[model samples]
Target: MDSLAGLVHGFSAAAQPEFLLYALFGVLVGTAVGVLPGIGPAMTLALLMPITYQLEPTAAIIVFAGIYYGGMYGGSTTSILLNTPGESASIVTALEGNLMAKAGRGAAALATAAIGSFVAGTIATMALTLAAPGLAEVAVRLGPVDYVAVMVVAFLTVGALLGASVLRGLAALGLGLIIGLVGVDGISGQSRYTFGLPVLGDGIDVVLVAVGLFAVGEGLYVASRLRHDPPELIKIGANRMSREDVGRSWPSWLRGTMIGFPIGTIPAGGADLATFLSYAAERKLAKGKRRAEFGNGAIEGVAGPEAANNAAAAGVLVPLLTLGLPTTATAAMMVAAFQRYQIAPGPQLFAENSALVWTLIASLYIGNVMLLVLNLPLVGIWVTILQIPRPYLYAGILLFAALGAFAVNFTPADVFLLLVIGLIGFFMRRYGYPVAPMVVGLILGPIFERQLRRALAIAEGDPLTLISSPFAVLVYAALVIIFVVSAWLRRRRSAASV
Candidate 1:
């Protein structure tokens, strides 16, 4: 009942004219970025972060949330039409979506993607709203040690699960820790990695890193791989789906949402994980004729992955809202935005900023609807964006990257750092090192360190006390079991394949 009341209040707040307009703007920008190759919502949001400083916190968050959903919707467009995935989560969609397009079922693929996203978004949003308050209540009881343990789990999980190799992921995480160590020490007030540079006293800006890695690095990588082959636009068939297509997709959407939402809310679980799992689930449940279409372009393949992507995106908000823990790069950026606004998420957020939290939740539903409406009718327009010349598109991306990075601090040093980081990012990508974990590490490292220190202080330097709490011990046990079981299963699967 209390949650219901809060939601009602949230709806009232989201209904305001200014908030609605911002939501629409966010969806528009997000969809555009998502549809375009080599651009993502994280980069788009980072580019907009400085500008958002002028808006109210609630409105800014509402807009950001809108972009998050809209980006997922737009990402599928490229995958289906151009055989290019705009976001990592859309990679699975490309497999079947592009096949469907080549087979002249492009309209069906696009419609399924859009409709599945809407259904998944709606269901996941409801799950977020209902689950968030309860989780927040549980989080309110956690001590410093518990918080430290939770963060360690998050760090380990993110680092281990993000990349092809745990070693590379940890290496990226170590780099982020090194970056986090640059500022003045919170406890001793001693500058560790500042190297006598005054600007380093405040630490590297998160926005700078985000823009450098996501925007500049991504643009440069794409430029280097630029092919002269003009993208063949998939012919648009009837935009409307037949009853048979609808029947096949609706169940897949539901099943994908069910699989995706819970997994996405877990530590180290994001859209990538969710989509893969959903694809597997769909494959497992597929009937005789449909089963044969697993590798080929099946409507279910496009539908399930698209649904999972949207559902996982919505589910990421659960931890962000309840514990101030960001499960994805975009969520990490949103954490930075919260800090810029002097707003702390977590259990206290619900108590202190109920209106803000609820309103943001409410806005997600509105955003999903807006995206569906925008995507379905504007499919042709989005596909037209693919005609943009590679050089011009990349040039524009580089320009935005420069402007966004410069906006962070207006310093020449920051620009130099952006270039340096961008170069590093380029190398990392070339070597198959995942960039997501590095951003996660950079964002979460400081928080983990702070909580660890606080826990130690409370424990009077007794190391055992760090895991003495029941919750901490339980979580650690779970982590150990998961790692061992997962490793064992992988070995078994490899042996069986051999």
Candidate 2:
């Protein structure tokens, strides 16, 4: 009953005209970025930081949440139509999504993705609403050592799970740690890697790195590949799914929601993992004609994974809101945004900013409905966006990338730094290194170090004190189990292939 009243109050707060406008704006921008290759929600949110910083805290978060959902929805369009998954989570969707497009059921594929996202998003958001308070209460009692252990687990899992090779993921993480360590030491009051440059004294801005890597680097790569022929686009046919299609998708959507929400709540459970798991589960569950259609145009393929992707996105917010822990790059950027307003997220958030938290939650419900409507009826419009000329598209992207970077501090040096970082990002992409681990590492590196140091300081500099607590011990044990299981699975898969 308390939860019901709080939700009702939240709906009232979020229904304000201005808040609704912000939500709409966020969804539109998020969809645009998601449809464009290489520009994910993290970069879009980072680039918009300057603009969104001026807004009220609740409003800013509402917009950011909208962008988060919009980006997830928009990625399915590109994955099905272009065979280019906009978000890594959508990669599993493309496994059969593009084939569905080729088979002329592109409309059905897209419908399933859009509706599944809505169903899963709504279910997961409700789960977040009910579970977040309990999680926050648990998080409030955790000690610094436990937090350090949690960070270590997150770091190890993110590094291990993201890229094709664990070595590559670790390498990217190391680079991020180095980049994060560039600024003045918060504890020691000493500059570390300024290189005598005044700009470097403040350290590299997270926004600059995100823009350079996600926007400028992608623009440059796209420009280089402009000479290649564009992929053939499938024309829109029936947008409505048949009764059979609807029946097949609903169960998969429910299962995906069940699978995704719990995984997302975990420190290492990301959208990519959830989507792949959902896909595998769906494939296993399918029988008869559906089983034969796995390699062909399978509607279940698009429905299940897309649902899981959106659900996992919602799950990430649970940790971010309840514990102030960011589980994804997008969540990391959101932490930066929250810090900009000096509104720390955690147990205190609900106590001090209950209105803001509740309103944000309610707005998510509204945004999900909005995204479903926008994605379904107007998909043709989004597809037409693909017809945009590459030269102009990339040129505009470069312009915005430069402008967004410069807007950070109104300094020319930021522009130069963006270019340098862009070049680095290009090479990283060329070499098959994943950008996400590096981004995650850069964001979490400082938090991990700070927690570890604090834990040690309290224990009189004993390193073993970091895991003395039962909670810390449990976290470490989980990390070890994850590593062992992952290694064994890899070995078995290799043996089977051979």
Candidate 3:
């Protein structure tokens, strides 16, 4: 009842004229960026985080939340019309969506994707609204050792499950941990890795690292792969769907929502696995004729995976808001955004900032509606956005990245650091190293360290105390279960692919 009342108040607050405009702007920009090749929401949020530093917290939160959802919606458009998916979660969408486009059913494909996203996203946000508060309440009772256990789960899952290989992911995470430990220790007042530089006294700003790795690094990498001619985008023909298409799509949307939301809430991984699972499930459930269409351009293939992708996106927010754990790269950037506003997203967040949290939640509902309205009517605009020249697009990305980095403290040093980190990011990508674990590590390392120290201090430095609590034991046990299950899932998926 209290949560419902708070949500009502949040709707009232979020419905204010100014806030509505911010939501519109965020969705517009987010959809635009999501349509562009090689630019994901993580990079867009990183670029915007520094730029949004001066806005009121509520407004910024609304905008970020809009981008979060809008990007999820827009990626389907790219996967369908363009040569490749803008993000990995959309890879499954591309498999069927692109086929649909080539087969001249692009309109039906896009329609189902847009509508499925709306359905799944709306349902999943409702789930988030109800679930987050209860989780926070339960999380409030947790001890430092429990938090340490949770962070360990976060570290292992994000590093091992997200990328091409576990070793590379762990290596990237180590790099981030090293960068995060550069400044003077808050408790001990001693710097560990500053290398005796005056600038090291303050530590490297997260804004620089984020903007550098995502925006600058992505820009440079894309630039290296730029072609002389723009890749052709499939024309989206009369954007409408048949009644038969609707019947085919609705069940998949619901099934995908069920599959995606639960996967999202857990620390197992992000939307990629959820999408694949949904795709496989839909293929299995299809009847004789529909099964024949699976590899070509089945509407179910376009609908279910897209729905799963969006639902998983909503699910990723659960751990982020309630426990301050980021399962996805974008969630990590969101944590950085919260930290910039001096807001931490753990259990205390609800009691301390109920209004803000509820408002953010409500705005998600509003954003879903806005995304559906915006995406359908403006398909032409998105097609134009997709056709943007690689050179100019990348140049603008780097320029915007530089400006955002410089705005961190308006210091040249920040810009220089941005470039240096960007170069490293380019190398990381070039060598197939995952950057997400690095960002997650950079953001969560200090919190993990703090919790570990407190847990040890309370135990008089006895390491065995780490697993003494029942909750901590459950968490660690869950980690082992997740690893074993994930390994089996991988092998099964590989066999199916073969």
- Lowest lDDT sum, 10 consecutive residues, model 1, at 488-497
**Which ten contiguous residues of candidate 3 have the minimum total lDDT?**
231-240
> What TM-score does each of the candidates earn?
0.96, 0.94, 0.99
- Residue 2, candidate 1: alpha-carbon lDDT: 92
Which is the leading candidate under lDDT? 3
Tell me model 3's lDDT, rounded to 2 decimals. Answer: 0.91
1-498: candidate 3 lDDT, tens digit per residue: 999999999999999999999999888888887888789899999988878988999999899988888888888888998848878888899988999898888989999999999999999999999999999999999999999999999999999998879899989998998899989999999988888987768988888898889998878987898789878888777646999999999999999999999999998878999999999999999999999999899999989999999999999999999999999989999899999999999999999999999999999999999999998878888888876778888888888898998888888888888999999999999998999999999999999999999999999999999999999999999999999999988887898789
Comparing 1 and 2 on lDDT, the stronger one: 1
**Candidate 2's error at 249, in angstroms?**
1.3
Model 1 quality (TM-score): 0.96
RMSD of each: 2.0, 2.1, 1.0
lDDT of each: 0.86, 0.85, 0.91
* Location of the lowest summed lDDT over 10 successive residues in candidate 2: 489-498
- For model 3, the stretches where C-alpha displacement exceeds 4 angstroms are none
| Residues 1-498 of candidate 1: C-alpha lDDT, one tens digit per residue | 999999999989898899999999999989988998878888888778877778999998988888888889999999988888998889889988999888888999999999999999999999998999999999999988998888877788777777678888878878877887778888899888888989788999888888788878877887898788887777877646899999999999999899789878976558987787788778779989999997788899989989999999989999988888887878887887887788988889999999899999889988988988988888889888888898998888778778777777888888888999899888887787777778878877888888888888888899998879999999898788757755664464356436
